[model samples]
Target: MSMRLQGRKAVVTGAASGIGAAVAARLAADGAQVFTADIQGEVDFVADLTGTDANTRLVAKANARMGGLDIVVPCAGISTFHPLEGHDDAYFQRVLDVNLIAVFRLVREAAAHLKAHGAGRIVTIGSTTSTYGDEGLCAYSASKHAVLGLTKSIAAELGPFGVTATCVQPGAIDTPMTAPAFDQMPEYRTFWEGKAPLRRLGKPEDIADVVAFLCSEDARFVSGHGLWVDGGAMVRH
Candidate 1:
C-alpha cells in the first residue's frame, strides 16, 4: 500500500460504523495513525461527541494516541427525516446538534493543535442531499449545507497557517446510513441507478479513495472545494 499518509496523525469521529469507519480503515491503510472515537468501543476511544466533556475527551485521546494531531475528520452525524408538518423544534435541534453543531465544536477544539503542525487537513463528510433537496430530508440537507460553509470558511481562514479544509459530499453509498432507505423504500434504487451515470450504488471505497487523495500531498494546492463522489447523480438529478 502507498504510504501517502505516513507520519500523519489524525482523528475521525463517528468511526464506529458507516463512512467514518471506512475512512478510519482507509487512513490507517495509507499509514496515518488514526484515532477513531464513537459512542462505543467499535474502534478506538469510546466517547460521544455531542457533549462538551466528551468532545474534549475525544480530542485528548487522539492526541495521546498519536502524540500529536495533523488531521481531523468529523464524520459523526444523524439524519432526522420528517415532513414539515410532522417535524418539531426539538427534533430539528437534535439533528443540528449531531450533524452540524457538533462538527463545529470538534473543529474549534482541534484547530490549535492542527495549526501548530502546519499542512494540516480537515475533511468533513457532507451529503448530496445538500446539493439536491428532497421532501423529507429538509433538516439533513440544511445541516450538510452548513458543512460546506464550514469547509470553505475554514480553508480561507487557515490557509495562511498551512492548513486546509474540504468537504466530501457523497451520494447514496451502500452503508448502514442508507440501509433503512434501501429496505423501506426499495424504489430509491431504481431512481439512483437510472439517473446516475455509473449505474450503481457507490461503495465506501469510492469515497474513501477520494479522502485519501485529499489528505495527501497531491491535494496540497486544493482547498475550499466540495468534491462530489456521486457518480454524476447530482448533475443528472
Candidate 2:
C-alpha cells in the first residue's frame, strides 16, 4: 500500500465482518488510524445504529480515540426478504432506520469534526438497488435510493468546508449479508455472476479500493458523486 491516508483518522461502522471489515482493514493498511464500530463484534466502539444517540456518541468516541476525525464510512445495514404484500411497518422501518437513517445521523454528527479537518471524506455504502429495484427488497431498495440523496445533500452543504461526501453503489458482493439469498436460491449466485460484464460476483475488497481512493487527497475534486463499483451490472440493468 502507498499509505495514501497516512496520519488520517477514520471510523468504519459494521466493522465486525463483511464489507465493513474489509474497508477498515484497507484504510488501516493505507496508514489511517481506524476506529471500528459494530453492534456485534470485538470493535473499538459497539452500539446499535438504531439507537437515537448512537451516532453522536460513536463519533465522539472515535474523535477521542483518534485525536480527530477525517473519514467516516457508515456501512451498517439490514435487509428482509419479504415481498411488498408481506412487508409490515416494523420491518420496513427497521431497514430504513439502519440503512438510511443511521447514515444521515452519522454524517450529521460527524460533520463538524470532518469540516474542521479541512479535507475530510465521507464515503457511504449504497447498493445497485439504490438505482434499480429488486424483488423482495422493497424496504432495502427504498433505503438505498434515499442514501444517494443524503450523500448529495451533504456534499452540497459541506463542500465549502473542504469536506467531500460521496456514495458507492455496489453490486452482488460475496458478503455475509447476501449469503442467505444465495443459499436459498443457488441460481441467484449464477444470475448475479452473469449480470455483470466481469462475469463474477464482487468481493468486499473491490468496494474498499474505491473507498480508499475517494478518501485520498487525489479525490479532492470528486464530491457529490455516486460511484458505481458494480462491475458494469448497471449497464445490464
Candidate 3:
C-alpha cells in the first residue's frame, strides 16, 4: 500500500520463519525489493551465519543481485535457556556466535556498500533482554545487550555518511521459536500477559512494522536508539 520504499533494495537475514519472515514480507509490502537469507529455507541465500564467510558473502550477493542495497535488517538470532551454573561453553558460545557475532559481521560486510549509497538504513533485532537481565537467559541477554551497544556505535560512526542504524528490542512475541514455550508453560504466557497493560503478547507484525518504519524515510532522523516494541510491558515492569 505504502510505496515509500518502491525503489529501495533491502537484504534481510533469518527469513526462514518467525520475526525474520515477517520482516522480509513487510519490507516487500512497503515496496522494497527484498533479498532474504537463512540457514534453511527458500530464500535468496541459504547461509549458515555462524560461519564467517557466509556473513560476508550474504551481503555481497545481495548487493550484486539487487544492483544496490539501501536497507539491511539482520534478524537472525538464537536463544537458549541455561542457568549460569552449568551454562556450558558450547551453548553460550553458540548463542553469542549466532546473535552477536553474525550481526557484527553482517554490518561490517555491508558497511562499504551502505556508505557508498550515502543513505543506508540498518535495522537490527534486539530483545527486551537487551536491557533487562533475566534468569535462565544469560547468554541471550548478554548478546542482546551487546547488540544495543553495537548499533549505537554504528550510528555514531556512520551518521556523517548518511547511514542510520538502530535496534528493535522486542518483547515476547508468539513466533515459532517461542510458541512451544508458551504452550508448554501456560503460566509463562499468563505472566507476560499480566505484565503488559495491553494484556496481550506481541505478534511478529508488531516488530515488523517498527522495523519497516526504521528503514523508511519516515525514520530518517531516528538513529542510534533501541526501540522497545513490547506493548507497554516494560512500563508495567
Residue 235 in candidate 2, Cα distance off native in Å: 0.9
Q: Residues 1-237, candidate 1: write the lDDT tens digits.
A: 699999999998888888888888999999999988887756787766778677777787788877999989988888745998979888888888888888998888889898999899999998887566788887898898888988899999988999989999998788877888887888987888777898988988788888888988889998997988999888876
Order of quality (TM-score): 2, 3, 1
Note the Cα lDDT for every prediction shown: 0.86, 0.93, 0.92
Q: How many Å off is the CA of 160 in candidate 2?
A: 0.5
lDDT by residue (1-237, candidate 3, tens digit) is 598888999999999999999999999999999999999988999979989699778888888898998898999998756789988989999999999999999999989889998999999999999999888999999999999999999999999999999999999898988887898889999999989888999999999999999999999999998999998999966
| CA RMSD of all predictions | 1.1, 0.7, 0.8
Off by over 4 Å in 1: none
User: lDDT tens digits, residues 125-151, model 2?
Assistant: 999888889999999999999998899
| Candidates by lDDT, descending order | 2, 3, 1
Scored by Cα lDDT, where does model 3 land?
0.92
Model with the higher TM-score, candidate 1 or 3: 3
Error of 1 at 168 (Å): 0.3
| Model 1's TM-score against the true structure | 0.96
What count of clashes does model 2 give? 0
- Model 2 lDDT, full chain set: 0.93
| lDDT at residue 18 of model 2 (Cα atoms) | 92
